[model samples]
Target: MHKYVKAERERQAQRYRARPHYEQRVNFSVGDYVLRSRVDEKLHANKLRVMWVGPYRVVGSADYYFTVEHLINGRTMDVHPSRLKMYADDSLNVTEELIDHIASQGTLLAVEAIVEYRMNSDMRAYEVKVKWLGLETVEDSWEPLKTMSEDVPQLLLQYATTTSDDVFRRAVTTAIDSKQSQRSTRR
Candidate 1:
């Protein structure tokens, strides 16, 4: 009888422990934006709790902790991964001014092509000429390929298919070769 009681107690404990209690984990990367949860711990706090605060920009990470910058005040803070959610501002419609603001502030630029490339002074990076979406030849600018690729892959794909630009293809080919060689060497 005592053994039966013990077994039943263990089963009950296991059932209780298996009940969901923790929030799901959310992953973040550098340059991603997120809002931090603001849960209150006081009595009946659920009724008064605010969900999130600040659309903070993720700047860096160390293990589970993230360093985020406040988009408005420019303040930097360290926050746990569990307390953060990806930020999406659908509150306003996409306008030209908003696009310009976000483009100027964030690392996102919708453009294509490495029309020309030159080795950086440090010999570690390449500056590639970028042709932005809906822009003319006169406004094209040189940007790092790393940033351009991350921002606009569709544009890159489109630009790479343009058979008319011989110089661009050769530059892109050389860069690809060097990158592949480096990766092989690293292994």
Candidate 2:
């Protein structure tokens, strides 16, 4: 009896051990939205100070890896499948034009626009206005302000506000023109 019990126990253990561990694969595509997990580490004070802070959009993807855009600091990052959860929607399909308009506008336009403009420019100053949905409307009329510089090109002076000389202007203009020419040629 004792021998039979021991053998049964061993058999059970072997069966349990033989079972394969299952891991789910999360596949994300470009433009599909996802969230990024944040890290919190007191031990590494200089490393991370927050935890799980995003419902970011998925910008790119590899086999099992995904790139998510974290909106907290306007950064896009890569994450593994284990760190994501699906976004839930509880509503049925309603084909209202107003609903479509609202959805297209999104909830975080002001924040994203500001971040994008700041990241893309090094010197140009911008004034931004954020209006709440239905509370205010945007007017569509404006002439862009132009700055005058006799010795320097206006575009160069826009970048190097402190410098005012033909040499600086020529160098900056040449660099910009070369870049534009290259881009045109590529197209």
Best by lDDT: 1
- Put down candidate 1 lDDT per residue, 66-179, tens digits, no spaces: 998765435578998877888753343435674455435433234645576566777666567877554567868988755555555445545656746665566555555566
| Model 1 spans > 4 angstroms off | 1-23, 39-48, 89-187
**How much lDDT does each candidate structure score?**
0.65, 0.46
Q: TM-score of every model?
A: 0.36, 0.32
Candidate 2 lDDT over residue span 1-187, tens digit each? 9999999999998887777644454655566555445455643575545344445666777876788764333456678877766542223232466344434432332211111011113434321222332332442111111111222234333654444555544545565566567769999
Clashing pairs in 1: none
lDDT of 2 at 186: 100
Taking the candidates one at a time, how many backbone clashes does each contain? 0, 0
